[model samples]
Target: DHQGKGTTEPGVMHQEPYGSLLPFGLHKGYALATMCEILGGALSGGRTTHDETLVSCHDAIFNCMTTIIVNPEAFDAPAMQQEAEAFLSWVKRSPQSGDAPIQIPGEWEENNRLEREREGIPLDTNSWEKICQAALQAGMPEEELAAFRALAQ
Candidate 1:
């Protein structure tokens, strides 16, 4: 488990979980997660998750990031753009396994963004009510909340 809820669905791996999640690819995934913890915590001089590092401690969280930056100019491939386009075209040409259309990398998010941009996001009544309640509980002025609610409607 990588401390997340188990699901076969894509695009939901980053969600906060209600329970532990199974690591992808089983042991190999577990190994990758272990390395991430090491690099993001110990190697980066940040604290790893523990009793003292709980999010509830101070209502703020600390994050450590490790990244690799590379310059495209450093590479010798003169036709990199065309090569990448060719590979992506080849992959997209393959038959999909299910009814859902094939999406490459950020395509799903981009599609959703465009749809939301055109249609606006749909929120169920229950969720909207809960958000209002939370704002009130957080000491929002009733008159201000009412103004915002009017705009939302």
Candidate 2:
């Protein structure tokens, strides 16, 4: 919402329309991103935007990721699962917005996965064309691409 031309303060100079990309929670979000960069880049011994990697290719992009996995059972909080269930139930009890029912974090994604599995995934014509082009470029035979394209329809 804050990216648009009129979103900024009156005196503030706006960038391109909807061009301002701020962190999610302003300062807190910025701090979180910085922490991730340090952990992912420095700790992982991978290059951040500041550090140069793959000196042979100027156009190469590098990605560094850090995943932290914690077991809830390791904690002494016995009521954690119950409390989480109660919170999820409370959130689901809220009124629906428009035609869609209220959903928790992963509910929508799970439902979408199920639906797409039952019924094939949907793709627009433009995207399908681009996918076919990519397949052709990746050395897929024209006859094979046509067969897959037929199945898509």
Candidate 3:
């Protein structure tokens, strides 16, 4: 059920009945994946992971996700806010698995944004290289790029 003997194949971790254990257990993850395949793959015109369509540049097959935004004005603000706060409080009150305190979904992202605002965003070497490449392609002077790097440090 695989390709020829010597061919480099996908990692065993990605195979069915095994990959289901990656983040969530089989039952929940399998259902979520099925729904995503239906909505993101079948609904979107874009290619699904199973699609054999090949592009020369990359080996990864991509799926498109559909996002719908909800307007806050359509719902009760104060009452909903109260319920959300209560739920978060209840979740946090659960016994901790480790010394680190529990954080709600948006908390880490909000903290990161605040930290980056106060102290400039930190980019890894590869990301900084990409930024330099972009600036260079846009005709930025090498001297200015060097200065920018210096300022970043």
Candidate 4:
């Protein structure tokens, strides 16, 4: 949909792509995105990126987000643990049809965490360099950062 190399305009069917940013699943994605912005911005009394140029967002502003925390101990701790275990057991009992066993949402995350805890997390060279840069900015000594660099490998 271009007349030249630099002329990357939208196709005739997709007019003004940047101005009319269409969602992947049409109305469904639009609704979800709208609701998410409403909850994070409107509910928190914070300004949203909507109706503002992208450049304006870099100005002094705090993007709001809501996080819900539940203390299991405050509720029926033992019963909740038992029920959770039972549900996991039931789900795991299902016959595996894929290369990997069926896993609930956070199961792989938990397993990954345990693995990382045992045999430290690996970081790529570029990401490790960025971390070193940030740590230096945060007052970490260059000498101390060398220790972290060793572990990053």
Which model scores highest in TM-score? 3
Q: What lDDT score goes with residue 125 in model 4?
A: 78
The candidates, ranked best first by lDDT, are 1, 2, 4, 3
Write model 2 residue lDDT over 1-153, tens digit each, in one string.
334443545432342221334667765788887787688877778765441543343422357777789899899999999999999999888877698788888899999999999998999999999999999999999999999989988
As for lDDT, the candidate ahead, 2 or 3, is 2
Error of 2 at 29 (Å): 9.9
Worst 10 residues of 1 by lDDT: 11-20
Task: Tell me how far the alpha carbon of residue 104 in candidate 4 is from the true structure, in angstroms, after superposition.
Answer: 2.7
> lDDT score, residue 111, model 1?
94
Tens-digit lDDT string for candidate 3 (1-153)? 133233244453355322212326635687787677667766777655442543332333465877658886798685887887899999999998889779998899999999999998888999998999999999999999999989888
Model 1, 1-153: lDDT tens digits are: 234545575544344432344667766788877787778877888866555655454322458877668787899999998998899889888897888877789999999999999988889989999999999999999999999889778
Per-residue accuracy of model 4 over 1-153 as CA lDDT, tens digit each: 223233334552244222334555765788877776677777877866554633565332357886668888887567898898899999888987778988898889999999999998876778877888999999999899998777665
Instruction: List the candidate 1 regions with Cα displacement exceeding 4 Å.
Output: 1-66
Candidate numbers, best TM-score first, in rank order: 3, 2, 1, 4
Clashes of each: 2, 0, 0, 0
Model 3, C-alpha of 32: deviation from truth (Å):
4.5
Provide the lDDT at 142 for model 2: 100
TM-score of each: 0.53, 0.56, 0.58, 0.43
Native-referenced Cα lDDT, model 4: 0.70
